[model samples]
Target: MTTAPVQKSSYDRYPTVPLPAGESVITGAAAWHRVRDLAYERAEDRPPLIVVDTYPGVDLPELTRQLAEAWPTAVIIDVEQEAAKPIEEIDARIADNLTDDRVFGVMSHLRLNAFYDQERLAALAERLADRTAATVLIGWGAALTATRPDALVLVDLARWEIQQRQRAGAPNWRSANGAEDNLRKYKRGFFVEWRVADRHKRDLFAKIDFLLDGNAIGHSSGVVRGPGMITGDAFRGALAAAVNAPLRVVPFFDPGVWGGHWMQDKLGLDTETPNYAWCFDCVPEENSLLLSDGDHAVEIPALDLVLTQPRGLLGAKTYARFGAEFPIRFDFLDTVGGGNLSLQVHPLTDYITDTFGMHYTQDESYYLLDADEDAVVYLGLKSGIDPDAMIADLRAAQQADHPFDTEKYVNAFPARKHDHFSIPAGTVHCSGANSMVLEISATPFIFTFKLWDWGRVGLDGVPRPVHVDHGAANIQWDRDTEWVTEHLLQGPEELSRDGDVIEERTGLHELEFIEVRRHWFENHADHDTDGTVNVLNLVEGDEVEVISPTGAFAPLRIHYAETFIIPAAVGPYRIRRTENSQSTRFATVKAYVRGTTRTDQEGPALAAGNKGVRS
Candidate 1:
């Protein structure tokens, strides 16, 4: 069968939700001028105090300079310099969480106030209270300096942007370790800085006077880089709109040792990069959300939507279970024209909880998007393989100059387009070369325990860290060839079919909390969120349209390989072929929390049975 050539540049790198009408976003000089006006307008009685609380990784010096330039006579206080604990002291306090391990760390419970000197904070607050001049306080913990401010502006940066800045040699907040390894910097941000900042920022969301887009800063001329500012009410409205409709997080691509040419060619990414290995398409913790007001869009951490509207976005049960976390993650693992992924295993739930203080583990699956004739997937282990022998070889491979004998122990299954491999936690697995993979998994994304890396160094020329001991402990020895074929290798088990739509249950393994479904439709497919969020990617065909049956949301067009999310509140929706699509049929693989129930009210014929359609 011949298929039309996939559209070039069909993948949307920047997906945004439209803000309500009349919601304006100001940027650059206008944004600065508006801050100046707000500072003056609220200073009728006391010294005007404008607290520009920032997420870590923002350019603080530049922000302070911009504020000074805007209000020449105002007193600008660098709150971190005045009130933050010394870098050495802060390091000592978070050392337990920031273990020497290169990749793993304990999630921190520390709040933003914990990183500041209480006495110094009091002194700064007192000093600001007595000052008669208009003062601007700016830093990560700027809001903590005042009980109430005349104008509270938050300069927010997305985690993905923060990572880019880290890659470009920016240090963690208040740390002078610009030369540190990017992984260690990321660990600090993930376990300590980001947690503390988000906790502090969440409380201020409703109280914020203005929201500034810090992700756009620090670009050279002709890059269209400038801070965008929106009113607090408008920002809240955008967040509400996002949770009530289908939306997408801004996707980001990165290169790796096992990178491929597919994304660079198909996704129209920068061709200059050696290869693009990973596309973090729906990892909300690290991705961003762009809120556009027709003309300008402000980028903020997508986690903000989860943090602020957990109920509306995640639904009541999921929010209650995960506690404001977007537990499901969907990303792309590209190995086409590249090397195999490192042999790895995720920790079991009990092990992860005991070791890292995380409540859940990375239960994941790999859905093949495209594969070459020779593509393969390393999954489970050869039947009756000695666990001790495998562990010893893995350990020796990590220390010595030899590559681990992969096929000797692990089962290598031939991978084909549309094949789904279920990889529950503790299942040893990796996507082999010449395959495009859509990884649907739980969101504890960084806890991968690599057993073997095929003896390759990273792009930085440093040997990638292999956790043989951790992998040995976590590997489920029982998941052998026979067990894997019967369990891990799953199906497109047809659940139901209407006139032109067929829905099938795809395996995420019964051990996992996530459920997957594949829908093949020539005309239209009916779907309901069933009181839980649904994430899907158009795995087949050029383009499709996601529409609300009741006009609950604007129709969203999804191209092949583009991932989008339907919030639990976006009850009933339909996916149909777009007028521009040339394909005879289309397929979408969707995922949602297992056991979520459908509402009493259904949409159409195919949506009648609760179990007939999943995700």
Candidate 2:
């Protein structure tokens, strides 16, 4: 069904509770007077909590003074009602802590935004969400669509109509009592609320809130949190404020509904697998993406590589791309990941058209996540095998047993952690069973170069397409294996705890969008919700929040690390270490935008007027 267009309204009367760590909650004039008078009369049992006024882009001796003043110190940062700092610098300030036992509470200037950036917002909020019930994260925000008077009336009507539905069985139940009661029940239903985010669910019943409750829900919104943040450009100011401070921060997502999937139930494609190794197409069901450890398909420089780390689940990926303009948008794909992948090479665009009817060749790389001892990759034509003999082997199925026939027909390399193989357009390759991989490749520039087969049928009861004729035609005369073996064998340095990863860069995967990193948050993993989505992955069979990438996040409960994908399209998101419960071990993937290339939209060579974009 089409979404009811959003309508804007304001709810100025709504109220929210401020943090209550002190007598004032928020040290307002009233709070300050109480403390000031206490000190004057020597009635204060505890030292006074002084509020320091600091300037924007300003560094004061406040932190040092606070620490020197007491055994335990705290900082409350507030700028003008509308203010912020660069998210990166804000993060650096908050990450500095005395110890887990010493509390670290970093708050933004107040997350008062009006748009729903599901990925960015959710990633930021999830960071504060805890798996255990010990600590609860409190978020405050508003939700609104556009502006329209009639829609506002509809919202009001809906609120009244709902109250009537649930009040049906109430002792005071009566249709005349109106629908607002039903609206209350709607909010109380854990099941329904869980179906969508708390805010979206509320929005559904908002019409009723408007109709009977006197427009309690904002047309835009008042202060609030998670999922149903106020709608429109309202959040831009809030987000900007957050990004400007040395505060805990991250991206977020609004749990709203969206649709799109590539792995359709095709005549031959089988898109089902509890395991998501092949979900390049299941945008709605399960979404994943390919992330390489380099730039521009560069030379397989190092030995080890981390491809396709896991992001949370399907929601993570979708929300990340909401409202984004991408050259090649990615999500969890639909692929036949289990079983032995066919031995194949992808035909470059040149080979596809010249040798086969297909427009492009499919030369792709698989960043394996799992594998068995028998796991082997077939890359390239055997060393010195004759073309006719190779074709003969395909006919007799002779290559099946010998596998790597002439050192050229195929090269068998056992799969291991972070291994990479550069399959030239014609080098045939297949990933064996029991292994999971993050498949990365150029756009559909070519089709695969299949050289052999297990000749197996997928869940759909269909064998994959075989491009033997084209594969044979496009096979590189002399193939290279050094880059593949070297890249896979060496690269990813099992990172050490600098305690914090200040910043660094790697190959192709330009620390673009959000750069992902993994670490522990619970066990006091010295935590704070930095306002980022933290996928809870109990790799130790324990629960924890995280934001890694790939299929790596799961299996951790079964003992594999799980990932949380935080969308970057929105304003800054944050992650807060909820309670001091489980250990917070996770990989954080930071987001960045790639520099525009000739292929990108409106890049220089394009229409002259396209030079300067988005102000």
Best by lDDT: 1
Per-residue CA lDDT of candidate 1, range 462-515, in tens?
889889888988899998998887776644567678888987777666678887
lDDT string for model 2 (220-339, tens) is 111121111121122112222222221111111111011111122221122232333342321111121111112110111000010111121112342244211111211222223345
Structural similarity to truth (TM-score) of each candidate: 0.95, 0.36
Off by over 4 Å in 2: 1-277, 281-338, 349-363, 385-388, 395-408, 417-426, 441-446, 458-463, 487-489, 493-497, 500-584, 588-615
Candidate that would win on TM-score: 1
What clash pairs does model 1 have? none
For candidate 2, the 10 contiguous residues with the lowest summed lDDT are: 297-306
Candidate 2, backbone clash total = 176
